[model samples]
Target: MKKANVAINKDLCKKCAICVHFCPKEVFTIDQDGYPLISRLDKCTGCRLCFLRCPDFALEVETELDD
Candidate 1:
């Protein structure tokens, strides 16, 4: 299985932490600036749930190509 990546676009982010709460696997966390960070990358199931639930479309989750 491929490892998934969760990226947060700081420019568009509102620092709402919505993506942090929406993730059932706790894939995200609030940073010092209150923006979302990938807290548990290994826990991610590549479900893209955080991105889908983001209201500002600041977060993006995708399958990473194998190296």
Candidate 2:
């Protein structure tokens, strides 16, 4: 399976848990400040739903290439 990396931009994030709720893989969790955090990166399926649904463009999903 392909590996995925999740990136969150704190500056752009508005603490709206949209990414956390939209992710089918449940890869994100809300922090104390209400920011999204990568909680289960290993379960990520490289789906861009979180990235595309983000209102602030703060979340990103990147597929990692195997060497």
Candidate 3:
């Protein structure tokens, strides 16, 4: 198993749903304001889909091996 962490920069993010849509694990959801939120941090596989798909470069995903 692995542990993953996700970070989103609200400032850089233009409220685009790319990260939300790109995430395979459905780790993100949209807030009322349409901003991205971490819905399932534990479910993240650290595939970097959100990070890579983010045009604004607002998303960061890090993974660590579970010991």
Candidate 4:
């Protein structure tokens, strides 16, 4: 399976929780600071929903093929 790296740009993020709500694999969670946390990276399917739905362009999902 391909592995995905999820990065959240804290500077750009507005704590909107859109990524947390839209992820099909439930890859994110709301942190204490109300920011989206990459909680389940292994569950990520690289579906790009979080990245595409982020209104602030704060989420980035990168997929790497496993050897």
Q: Give per-residue CA lDDT, model 4, range 1-67, as digits (tens).
A: 8888999999999998989998899989999999998888889988888999999988888998886
Segments of candidate 1 deviating more than 4 angstroms: 64-67
Could you tally the backbone clashes for each prediction? 0, 0, 0, 0
lDDT of 4 at 48: 89
lDDT tens digits by residue: candidate 1, 26-61: 877788888887878998888887788788888777
TM-score of each: 0.84, 0.90, 0.92, 0.93
Candidate 2 per-residue C-alpha lDDT over 1-67 given as tens digits, one digit per residue, 9 for 90 to 100? 7788889999999988988898898988998888888889999989789899999988878897655
lDDT of each: 0.82, 0.88, 0.88, 0.90
Candidate 4 has a TM-score of: 0.93
Best candidate, lDDT? 4
The best candidate in terms of TM-score: 4
Which regions in candidate 3 have their CA more than 4 angstroms from the true location? none
1 versus 2: better TM-score goes to: 2
Backbone clash total, candidate 2:
0
Clashing pairs in 4: none
